[model samples]
Target: MPDRRDLDIGELMTAFDAVVRANASLMTQLSSRAGVHDTALRALVLVSDTGYSTPTEVAGFLGLTSG
Candidate 1:
């Protein structure tokens, strides 16, 4: 049988509120360790997903600059 504690964690992780909270907590921890602003991590994630993006494009999409 699946461990009850593991099942509880899985259910909690699947919850939208739990997922968002967990993501925010992890991002905070990661940004602190990486020595970069949280927005920088967000921008990196956005840039990595789009192969054809440029700096201007990314800035515009990220609202860091006027499009």
Candidate 2:
């Protein structure tokens, strides 16, 4: 495992931000190719981030009525 003690917080944050921007860009591209709206793409990302496998959990996270 890498040494966490040797990592600079500022540098780590910068790297993380870069990766997030790249991921967002990729998601945008994929959304366009899939013909999905931005909201649906964002919801998919949110579901993946939250590790919610059930629609009920996703709906709760999205503040939607699970009907």
Task: Tell me how many residue pairs clash in candidate 1.
Answer: 0
lDDT of 2 by residue, 1-67 (tens): 5576557776788899999999879888999998997668878988788776587666666578745
Candidate 2 residues lying further than 4 Å off, grouped into runs, are 1-7, 42-52, 60-67
TM-score of each: 0.57, 0.56
Candidate that scores best on lDDT: 1
Of candidate 1, the 10-residue stretch with the lowest lDDT total is: 58-67
Question: lDDT by residue for model 1 over 6-64, one digit each (tens)?
Answer: 99988876897877889889888898899998778867877788757788877887688
Clashing pairs in 1: none
The RMSD of every model to the true structure, in order and in angstroms, is 7.1, 6.6
Q: For model 1, state the Cα shift of residue 19 in Å.
A: 0.1
Pairs that collide, model 2: none
